[model samples]
Target: MNRRLLVAGLIGIAFAAAAYALMAPAPESTSRPNVAVAVELSPAERGSLVTRRRFAGNLEPAAEFQVAPKVGGQILEVLVDIGDSVARGDIVTRLDDAEFQQSVAQARAELAVAEARLQEAVSAANLATRRLDRIERLEARGVASASELDDASGEAQAQQATVAVTRAQRDQAEAALNSAEVRLGYTRVRADWPGEDETRLVGERMVDAGDTVAANTPLLSIVDIDQLRAVIEVPQSLYGGLAVGDPAQILPPGRPDSEALKARISRISPRFDPESRRTRVELIVDNQDRRLAAGMFVQVGLESRRVEDALIVPRAALVNRQGRQGVFTVAPDADSARFVAVEVALESDDRAALRGVESLDGPVVVLGQDQLTDGAAITRAGQAQRS
Candidate 1:
């Protein structure tokens, strides 16, 4: 019975040991150590900040003119061709003058006939006046009857009326001749630009020798390329800041690295395009050397706004955290440099204007900012690389 009691005591000890192992708690772990992030930093600078808007545009001539014939005829000769330079009043083309010359000759012959008739009428009027005077004197002397005197007066009046009618006919003939001469002059197509010695480029030639064309048919297109217009479509958001006389920089595609041509806004469309929500703006650029040409693509940069004495940082410093746009600035700490979040005001391609953070005397994290949080530890890139 003693042996059985000892075996029961051993079993009871094993059960108590198992219960204690199941109910015991686990030990606590030590806190994670802070990690030092390597980053590039730049000091905030106080300087001027200019905001610009860029747009793609095309260069066009400031003025364009269409050369057309004023009279219908077969083209006899095309004096100017495409790419030709012409001045005001220069003859561009000529039409067949055979028909027009014939018309002019006919008009001149009619004028000559009218002049001969007028001369004949004048002679008759002079003779009738002399005869009437003689008849009146005879009647006063009682040598001629009153009937003869009346007949002489009537004849003289009739001759005078005939002279007036001939004079009217002569005037009509002269007008007809002048009109014919004017029409003949229209057969010679001439460039009629506004200013003297203003050279224009012939953009297109629509007619050739022996081609028949009607009045007002386009024969050539001329454009003044000394002054070019850079036309750009500006969105509604940026249209408000644009105004006439505002300065602009024009970069022609051909000479991208060359100095930008200085230009000014000359015109802005009063109405907006509903489909595009944009407006057209015209910038005038001087090209006296003819370096720029119409239909060339160009880039236009316009200064929209300017800020003075603003705190600026590199664009890389900006970060979006919790739906907030900000930058990480270095803050002093006893053990390491800490990152502090500062809000961004305005941003450009390479730089950003910052605001809402006091004491910008500290450095800003340019690189390695993506992994940064408020109060996170950081190390300067140079120092980290050396270590």
Candidate 2:
């Protein structure tokens, strides 16, 4: 019985050894990794970039002139009121001229009387001179006394003096007449400007008809709307790219979809505001259509810069690696990817301008870079090998 038991134990030990050998872990699989990949992309096509820089500003008339009276008088009539269209030399206001006309007539009469007196004095002076000449000849011939000749000369001198006095009086009278005429002319007030017509848009009436107005009193305000100015204040820290003759755009406020008007930079304030730390720029626009007005809020756009023939890439494709900027480039075999550092220059919209690329023919990964390493095998989207 002991021998039989020994044989069974030996068989059991052999079967256990065979089972352990069969259940042992198979050799480690040496299969390749299946990494998910993003699709490769190319840079966006380049064309004319209408870049714009916007700023809030105010609208104003390019040229504004204040209408006022030149002389002081009682306003008898107001021919033109506020918002009245007037031509050059149009009668805007009138003053009381009855008293002024009477004064002119009196001056004219005084001038006529002075002229008559001057003519009579001249005739008398001529007669006295002839008498003096005859007396001088008679004294030379020893026919007249020397005392008589001296008396005739004295009479001539007196007459000459009288004539001089009358002439002076006539000159004074003429000056008075001119003064009266000028004063009378002040009664008719006309628009004084060089243009063929004065463009009256808005005005303020300070006095009514029959109201007395002082010299240089502001009767009303008139502004020309044919041309307008768009003024904008820019911060000092920003680059000043606007200068005279530069192209600009003026956009009216309260309307987002309205088309912006085109204009040109015409003036720049030499003095900068100390408190606001900004400089003012003015843009001139031809508003012959009268669509723009003064004191309206607007926005100004100045295109001061442009980048041409610049290489641009998607901003999302760039990654930061140990404080260095890098992008994932597809491998030459087209089945893997590698990280390469690049230098960026400018950023606009969602694209970036970068350098350090040998060529643009290589495909670039647009996504899936967080879990990627150098030379990692990847399966691109839509490829037959992709899961």
Candidate 3:
């Protein structure tokens, strides 16, 4: 009976071992279809690679000069109105010149009188000299007394002094005439800037005709709209890569396919806004057609800095894992893929410049990265060449 029982226990142990072998999980299927993914990549080229930094900014006229009155007077007429084009030295407004004209006439009359007086004094002096000469001749001949000769010389000297006084008065009248004429001229207001007749943009009129204005009081504002300046505020940290004369691209939103307007950095604010920690950069662009107006928002791009000619990929192609940015690149056979870590230099709309890895020579997986492992096999391939 003991032998039979021992044999039964042995049989049960063998059965348990058979059941464990059948229930064990099967090895992972190596035949399952590898993850299928689409990819995009960038080919290395010698073309310009710009480190485009975008900032929000407003478009403004390159220059605006206020048109103001040079003297206090009532405005007689305004030759130009808002949106009127003007050239250099073009009169914009006029003041009432009635008083100034009368002053000029009065000065001219005074000057004429002074000239007449000067001519009279000249004639009297000539006569006095001639008389004194005759008297000296007579004195030399002993026909004139010493006292008489002295009196003749004194009369000539007095006439000469009168001529000098008249000439001084004439000079003073001439100066007054010049001042009166200048004041009359001040009644006509002219454009402050010299620009082509077609390029002027005139703003609101501060004073209308018949209204009086003080000297230096703004009559109107004239802006040259032939060119526009885009003022962008850039973070101080990124200021190092930007400088005057650097090329930039301006993208006016909602126009994607339109050619980017070219611009250059014209001014860089040395000081940063304390509240925003950003520096203002001014970009000048020609708008000869006046197509760009002030206050229009523009996207400013500063170009060409670091990591040129790097292998680039669409930003969507990347995946982050454990603080490392990586993407799955397909093997040559198009049947397998391997994860690769890449160093990013710059990012644009939907693409980024990448570095690291000897050869990112083939297509990279843009989608389906989350399901991928280090050595995952891929069945689908990217027909589009890598950007």
Q: Rank the candidates by lDDT, best first.
A: 1, 3, 2
Candidate 3 residue-wise lDDT, 240-342, digit = tens: 8777998888888776724678999999999999999998899999888666777799898787465655676777778886788887777556566677888
* Model 3 residue 46 CA deviation in Å: 6.2
* Tens-digit per-residue lDDT, 63-140, candidate 2: 655667767889988787766776666677888889889999999999999999999999999999999999999999
Error of 2 at 62 (Å): 2.2
- Best by the lDDT measure: 1
Q: What is the C-alpha RMSD of each candidate to the true structure, in Å?
A: 6.9, 9.0, 5.7
Off by over 4 Å in 3: 1-54, 194-199, 232-236, 239-242, 249-260, 271-281, 297-305, 320-341, 357-359, 365-387
Ranking by TM-score: 3, 1, 2
Q: Which residue pairs in model 1 clash with each other?
A: none
Number of the candidate with higher lDDT, 1 or 2 = 1
Identify the superior model by TM-score, candidate 2 or candidate 3: 3
